[model samples]
Target: MSNLEIRDLHVTVETEAGTKEILKGVDLTINSGETHAIMGPNGSGKSTLAYSIAGHPKYTITQGSVTLDGEDILGLTVDERARAGLFLAMQYPVEVPGVSVSNFLRTAKTAIDGQAPKLRTWARDVNTAMERVDMDPEMANRSLNEGFSGGEKKRHEIVQLELLNPKFAILDETDSGLDIDALRIVSDGVNRYSAQGDRGVLLITHYTRILRYIKPDHVHVFVAGRVAEQGGAELAERLEAEGYDRYVKAARAGV
Candidate 1:
């Protein structure tokens, strides 16, 4: 069985208006070395699902449970979840104006690893990860994502993914706003992390372009607030050709 499981999960967010239901009910299981692609329309609860999985405080679990290896994780804090080997590379990576990339990475790595990586070797690891993402090693000394281009921000997330080595990762729309070359570099970095063989990935995207490079073991079409269809990699190609018209209609009809 795959380690990560979400069973009939429902989530709500406390917005200024009130508690807003985001994830109606989501069920999915991901195992080692498997990639699952979640394709959904905007506001279809894709990012919400990722955040709920990562134990984001803003997302309240109204029902169901998320378990890793048999232990329920709904009660875990964000940092606790991270230490349990769960990661979410957000669609929008925020910049820290004063913290250098190297400092942020060092802090994050130590937190995730539960101990500091060897000081001398940490720099080497950071440089290698940066190079894999096509980033200059010099960028490591710059403030984290400060004034970085969209592609640069996304690449920085992949760099963190590499250094943290999380067992399970939800890549929330990491392919957005990338040019062809940037897309290729980001995909390569994702592949590098998946090469670990025991790692699981939930890749959330609106378009299937990234799937062409990093094929998914399964593809799910999420419409409205729930999953509408699912299949193997070929499902992604079908959606690319036909668009989401039929699936959205199907979701409406079912609703």
Candidate 2:
């Protein structure tokens, strides 16, 4: 079984003012078939952790180790990390002006798999993935994320997730900007992907609504860049009712 482990991860970024530490220290392990939800207030370093794991150059890992199946991932480049079965669905997917969605997906798949998928099967697979996310067939011809709605961008991310079939998926606020129907469709797509029984998912979000559809095996409450509390699904329900006020207060008071 595959495992993704983060040990005492500390990260920082260079802002206009100066360098600022984001992640203080974080330790978590996700085994295959497990879904872990990280719920936190804004600026709690949730997205920083996701970007760090995905090898974003802007976030400097001052200390800690991230490993996938016992292999050190910190040393790998972004593309290399992708090849190692790590995927990140950004909150704001950027637009690639000239790259058609179809070409981008196929190229990414080829790079990760070290081979070009057979043309016919690949085309069929692409169409199937798009349909699963409720995307129009015509979207395949559009430049990636260019002139797309926020919901469309999020849906496209899921399409990539389904096609790439990564071992671990880090979805940073994937539920953002999705309407009720779109949320259900996107959640369904995520559920289908997670049902494979051999993949791990790190779902980071601010609200508990998505949890109603995509049940997490463990729910971690992130406070001040660290996990202050963790429990089963019941914890999420409590957070939904009580909110993060208690945790935020405790963190501010140096708890």
Candidate 3:
């Protein structure tokens, strides 16, 4: 099975003041067939870890290494990381005004696979994936996420996940703006993809709601950019009951 490993990852970004470290020293490992959930409060660096692994330009890896199957990916470009079997579902999917959803998916799939898929089969696969996510087939001809609702944008992200079938998927708060029905549909799509038993998922979120539909094997509490606690499904239940207050207090007290 493949493995996505992060080692003492420290990420920073430039602001008006100066370089500020978002990830202090984070370490986590997600193997194929496993789903790990990162739960934390706001400004705790959950999304920073996701973007860092995806090789986003805005975040700089000041120290630490991220590797896929023992190959360091810090040196790879954003597209190179994707080609290496990494995918990131942004917390806020941006609008691509001119790029039609169908064309965008096809182009991304072609880029990751290193060849253009046969048109007839590609079209069918796209439709099938979109259907799985309850996305309107007609919307495929529209600009990517340009006029879509929050739920639609999130569903479109899942469509990409289904079509691209990356080795690892880093979902950054995919459950944020989705309603109950939409949440279940999106969760089902994720489950279908992970059921292949050869893919890894690192889902970052602020709440445990999504965990009900997408159960993670491991639950980690991120506090002040570091993993404060690790446990099983029970941990999520505890978080739901107790909240992150204790974790936040502990971090503040330097516990």
TM-scores of the models, in the order given: 0.96, 0.99, 0.99
Once superposed on the true structure, which residue ranges of model 1 sit more than 4 Å away at CA? Answer: none
What is the C-alpha RMSD, rounded to one decimal, of candidate 1? 1.3
Tens digits of per-residue lDDT, candidate 3, 1-255, equal 999999999999999999999999998999999999999999999998988898889998889999999999999999999999999999999999999998999899989999999999999999888888888799999999998999999999999999999999999999999999999999998999899999999999999999999999999999999999999999999999999999999999999
TM-score of model 3 (CA atoms): 0.99
Better of 1 and 2 by TM-score: 2
Task: Tell me the tens digit of each residue's lDDT in model 1 across 117-171.
Answer: 9989999999999998889999999999998999999999999999998989899
**lDDT at position 11, candidate 3:** 92
Backbone clashes counted, model 2:
0
Over 4 Å off, model 2: none
User: What's the residue-level lDDT of 140 in candidate 3?
Assistant: 95
Residues 1-255, candidate 2: write the lDDT tens digits. 999999999999999999999999999999989999999999999999999999998999999999999999999999999999999999999999999999999999999999999999999999999898889978999999999999999999999999999999999999999999889988998899999999999999999999989999999999888999999999999999999999999999998
What lDDT score goes with residue 3 in model 3? 99
Ten-residue stretch with the least lDDT total in model 3: 127-136
Go through the candidates in order and give the clash count of each. 1, 0, 0
Best by lDDT: 2
